[model samples]
Target: MPQTPHIAFIGAGNMAQAIIKGMLAAGYPPNKICASGRTQAKLDQLTADTGIHTSIDNLSLCDQADVIVLGVKPHMMGDLVKSIAPAIDPSKHLIVSVAAGILAGSIDSWLGQTTPIVRCMPNTPSLVGKGAAGLFATTGVSSAQKHTASTIMQSVGLALWVETEAHIDAVTAVSGSGPAYYFLMMEAMIAGAEELGLSNDVAQQLVLQTAVGAAQMAQESQQTPAQLRLAVTSPKGTTEQAIDTFNKGDFSQLCSQAMAAAHHRSKELANLYKA
Candidate 1:
C-alpha cells in the first residue's frame, strides 16, 4: 500500500463530513486529517467530532496537506482551485475533487496543466459508509495516485474507475443518483401499501427490509439478481402479481428514462462549468 498522505478537505459541509467520518472508520487518525470552509461553526463541530484540524483558510490547509479534497459546491469550485493553486505543489500534492459538475480538466486549467487531478462523484450514502463513488484521473496522475483516490473513496462504499471521463456521466446516472432512485421506489411502495390498507410503518418495514435483504442476498450469494427475483416470485402468487403490474407499466423503460434524464443534466452542468 502507498503511504497514506495527510488529507485535507476544503469544505466542511455534509459531504465533507461524511468523507471525514468514513476516513476515520478506515483507520485514518484524526491528526492526519484537516477540514476548512467559510463556516467556523461547522469547522468547530468537525474539530470536535474528529481530532482533525479545521480552518477557514483554504490556502493554509492546501499548504499543509498532501492530498487535497475539494468538497465545495460547483459554483465555488473555480475560485477555490485558483486560490489554492499557488499553494499546491504538483510533485507532492494530489488534488481530488468531489464537486459534482467540475471536471478534472477544469481543475488542471485553474491550477496548472500538470496538476495531478482526480474527479470523484460521491453520493449521500457516504454518511453511513455506503456510498458509491465514480472516479476518474487525468492524464498526468500516477497509478499510485489513482489507487490512493480509490482507497479514499472505497472507505465509504464502492468506487469505480471509468476508462474515460465521458463515462462518468453514465456513472452519475446509475450509482451517483442511485440512492434517490431507491428512495423513490420505497416511497411508491409505501404509498401503494397504504392504499392496500397496511399501516404506513408496517408497509415500509416489508418493502424496506425486502430491499435490504435482497441486496444482502445478492452480495452474499453467487446467484444473480434475475435469479433472486425468480426465487422470490412464486407461481401466480402476490409476488408474481406485483411483477406483472411492474412489467405492464414498463418499469424498465422508466428506469432508462430516469437515467437518461440524469445523464443529460450532468452534461448540461459540465457545459455550464465550461462556459
Candidate 2:
C-alpha cells in the first residue's frame, strides 16, 4: 500500500458521505479520495462539498484507487463488481463493502478472482459519528490492508471484527437493525408521555434526552446493564413496577424473537446473490 493510499467510493449516498467526512476529519488528503455515482448532480455536489474528485464513470475510477468502497445497495453489488472487475487489480486494490448481507466469497466470484474483500455492516448512527460496525475480511487481505480498512471505519465510530462471515448476519441483527428497535421504543415512550398529557415537543425532548443519558451512563458505568437497572429499581418502587410489567409481558423473549427475525431476513437477502 502507498504511504497515503488512494481510496475511492463507488456510491455517493449517505453512508459514503459520512465515511468521507470522517476520513477528511482524520487528515486523509481529499485529493486521494474519489467518489463515483450515477447522478451527475450528486457527483457535482460531493465534489463541491468535499473538494474530492467525483465522476459518473465507475470503471475508470477503479484504476486510480487503492481501496475501493462498494457503498451501493446489495442488489446492485454483483453487477457493479462485474462491471469494474476488469479495471481492478486484485493484487493491489482492496475492496471494502458496506452493503449488508453480501459475502466476501460472492464478491470474489463476481470479481472473477480472489480479491481482498472486507465486508462491513455499519448502522445509521454513522451519520453522527456514533455508529457501530462489524467487519469480516477474506484471506487475501493483508495485515496492512486490514489496518487501512479499520482506520476508515474507526474514523466514524466503533469497528469490530467477527470470527466468521456468518457472524456478520448477527451483527446486522444486533447493530445494523438495532437503531430501528431503539427508535420504536422511543416512539412508544413519547406516545405514552403525550397520552399522559405532556405536550409533543416536551415529550420528545424528555425521551430523547433520557435515551442519550442512559446510553452515556451505561458506557461510563463499570456495572453491567442488568446491574445498573437493579441499582435504579428500589424495593417495590416505580422502577420495580415497570420492570415487573416488562418481565410479565416477556419483553426479553420478544426482543429475542425480533432479532431472530432480522437475522433470518439478513441470511435470506444474501441468498439473492447465490447462483
| Best candidate, TM-score | 2
Best by lDDT: 2
Model 1, TM vs. native: 0.96
- Positional deviation of residue 131's Cα in model 2 after best superposition, in angstroms: 0.7
Clashing pairs in 1: none
- Per-residue CA lDDT of candidate 2, range 1-275, in tens? 98789999999999999999998998999999999999999889888899999999988789999999999988888899899999989889999999987888898898888899999999999999999999998888899999999999998999999988999999999999999999999999999999999999999999999999999999999999999999999999999999999999999999999999999999998897653
lDDT of each: 0.87, 0.93
Q: With candidate 1 superimposed using the best TM-score fit, by how many Å does residue 171's alpha carbon deviate from the native?
A: 0.8
Task: Give one digit per residue, the lDDT tens place, for model 1 in 1-275.
Answer: 13777888998889888888888988988888898988788788878888889999888888888889998889988888888888988888889989877878788888865788888998988889888889988888888888889888988899989889888888899988999999999999899999999999999999999889878899999989899899989999999999999999999999999999999999999978862
Those runs of model 1 whose alpha carbons end farther than 4 Å from true positions after fitting are none
Q: Which 10-residue window in model 2 sums to the lowest lDDT?
A: 266-275
Residue 52 local lDDT, model 2: 98
Q: What TM-score fits each model?
A: 0.96, 0.98
lDDT for residue 18 in candidate 1, whole number 0-100: 86
